[model samples]
Target: SQQGEEDPQALSIQEGENATMNCSYKTSINNLQWYRQNSGRGLVHLILIRSNEREKHSGRLRVTLDTSKKSSSLLITASRAADTASYFCAPRDEKLTFGTGTRLTIIP
Candidate 1:
């Protein structure tokens, strides 16, 4: 599988706080994307940053990619209970492989 591995199988944060998660892949990739899954639902694309890019931000989401280290990090600022969900990072390919994911919980 081309899927990368992510740390912190679960995370609990309070509302208005921040959450961070990391991911590491084995092979090189063109781009990496962060997705959020609510309970037993489909994944929602949060952000995507190419290998040529170091960092990208969207609203409360900030993502950083390091090709040399084959790793990436996602940061969510001022998190809310509505943001509670599992986050998975995957490579941008025809067959996208997903990691186990980080189960995030935001306390209200």
Candidate 2:
């Protein structure tokens, strides 16, 4: 399977502003998972929206998947300093494909 990559590679925004990141894949997937890794912490599972689902939300986070476009997007509302982390998306399969991820900086 081909690895999907995150768009914008990096983003910076004020603490209270919303942040959005896009991920695009090369092949079909069963499900797509989103993750966040703080400076020194392990990747934290954020959202796992399936191929049949269009949107899912967890707290201030929203995930939208458009299988037709073979793409997904992650939106973080009411961002905070703690939101400063690298976000990654992976496809659920026997061989998982996860890209480098998008680095987000929240300026206080």
Candidate 3:
């Protein structure tokens, strides 16, 4: 399990605003992925950035990876109340390991 710790355990924001969360890992990884979990449900894959890639974006979500620092960040643009959930980063070589996630609350 290469997944490490994530920072700022939680966050709150207003709708139409942006939310950013960061993650840090301790070992070498092939790629990093971000996932979103609603309340007590299963996680859904949001985005993935490879070690060779610096940044990636999907819809309103953006991801950045800094391999030298063993850290990554996820940014959600124009957030909505429905976007409120827990976000996690999984730094993986072969298997995915999830760290403590950041809980985001979006005020409508």
TM-score of each: 0.95, 0.95, 0.96
Off by over 4 Å in 1: none
Query: Candidate 3, residue 83: CA error in Å?
Result: 0.6
- Give the per-residue lDDT digits (tens) of candidate 2, residues 1-108: 766799989999999999999999977888999999998888999989999999999999999999999999999999999999999999776676679899999999
Candidate 2 local distance difference test against the native: 0.92
Backbone clashes in candidate 1 total 0
lDDT of 3 by residue, 1-108 (tens): 677577779999999999999999988999998999998899999998999999999999999999999999999999999999999999988887888899999999
Candidate 3 local Cα displacement, residue 65, angstroms: 0.4
- Tell me how far the alpha carbon of residue 98 in candidate 3 is from the true structure, in angstroms, after superposition: 0.9
Q: Best to worst by lDDT, what's the order?
A: 2, 1, 3
Worst 10 residues of 3 by lDDT: 1-10
Task: Report backbone clashes per prediction.
Answer: 0, 0, 0
Q: Could you give candidate 1's per-residue lDDT for residues 1-108 as a string of tens digits?
A: 489788889999889999999999988788999999999899999999998999999999999999999999999999988999999999766569998999999999
C-alpha lDDT of candidate 3 relative to the true structure: 0.91
